[model samples]
Target: MNIHVSYPSRLYSDKLSLDCGSTRICHDISVAIPDRGFTVIIGPNGCGKSTLLRGLSRLVRPSAGKVHLDGKVISDYSTREVAQRLGLLPQSAQAPEGIRVGELVSRGRFPYRRAFSTWSDEDERAVLAALQATSTLELIDREVDTLSGGQRQRVWIALALAQETPVLLLDEPTTFLDIAHQIELLNLLRNLKETGNRTLVAVLHDLNHACRYADHLIAMRDGRILFEGSPAEIITPSNIEALFGLRCVVISDPVSGTPLVVPR
Candidate 1:
């Protein structure tokens, strides 16, 4: 898979600082999300990967510095404008009780419709495509609350896909998924990246999966990015030990030829 790439994209940050309530999470972090590549943020617990994702997506305003999209400050844009350009799947996403899957997914079209605007064929197509992309089309009419954890996760991803933004930010999307579903989701993300028109950024805890699927890997520790590069260039045993305090052996994955980490 030709994963490593940096073409062009609007999503980038300059010395972005973030706060979780009164506590500061990250400081002076800068990242340029590739125009058509997969960027994964990896770190130990409490290292602020999720907070960085939120900052990039504008779910939370940067405490300092700026997040820029297409050379403009992201915060300066209207909420609708932001939604049109960026889609976000937060880790704690929840659905309203009794909300059907179709209804929830349709909410992604909110930015495209006005108060009196009717649901157009374009909207329907996007929703259906998103559902199919996530393999959730069969459950389109099901209640969101009734699905299993992995199914619900897929549905949430479908909602983000329905947004149809060129830039998508996800926070631990594999959470609540079993091993098989996790691989399935990562493969789906890889398929999305094949379009060469979308920027996919995610925070993932699975080091080996990150290596396999990420075009660019960012390692964070104590609220700072320790190092970043292609997985093969950065996923060394020394880097693994520094990032997670684990002694590990790094080798090539038999399937993808990407780096694979095994703790000693």
Candidate 2:
């Protein structure tokens, strides 16, 4: 069966700037996120990738400019309304001690519930589906602290999935995972993008993985976007060098025919 999904119009920033106290992190940044694609943001550490992600999610109010969601100012929407349309997974998410996996994931449904309404069948279905999709259904009753790093990461992702939003933003989702787990998580994200008409945005450190899995790439440097395009168009050695100030060898992945970067 074919399912038709309606996504909010692409989100974009106009002359966006971010400041924390007296420090300026991002400046005059403007870019449009595609309506339905996996877009990876890559850059050197402390280059404002995370800041930009926060701005996009409305977690950080921009110092200047505005973020538009579906042609409407994002700050104008009610918090619950925005939550129902967008979900953000930060790099470091801590579950309360002794929290059960199911209970942790169920929090994502909060936006769908009225203040005094009890959990309904639809909420239960969404929670179960998210757990199953992330392959964490079997761990539903387990304490989050007992899971491996990879498993815990999946649980967090499941929580975001349970939100059932059209726009999903992840900040450094593979931060603490080993190589195998990193690949696993990336593959899971790829599967999620393919299975639904959703837009996935992630801050990725591994350029090769970003190129391989992302349909679009946004390269940033020193708080500014250096380039934004398809992996094939933006993953050249010159671009990589400009973005990360590193010399690298760029080659094609044998399986996916995407660019692979070998740092020099």
**TM-score of each candidate?**
0.94, 0.95
In model 1, how large is the Cα lDDT of residue 262? Answer: 89
Task: List residue ranges in candidate 1 displaced over 4 A.
Answer: 1-9
| lDDT agreement of model 1 with the native | 0.89
**Residue 255 shift from truth in candidate 2, angstroms:** 2.5
- Ten residues in sequence with the least summed lDDT for candidate 2: 1-10
lDDT of 2 by residue, 1-264 (tens): 111123345687878898877899988887888888899999999999999999999999999988888778999999998999999999768999999999999999999999899999999999999999999999999999999999999999999999999999999999999999999999999999999789999999988889889998888888888888899997888888888788999988989899989888
- CA lDDT, candidate 1, residue 158: 88
Minimum summed lDDT over a 10-residue window in model 1 is located at 1-10
**Residue 130 in candidate 1 has what lDDT?**
93
Candidate 2, residue 23: how far the Cα is off, in Å? 1.1
Q: For this target, which candidate reaches the highest TM-score against the unseen true structure? A: 2
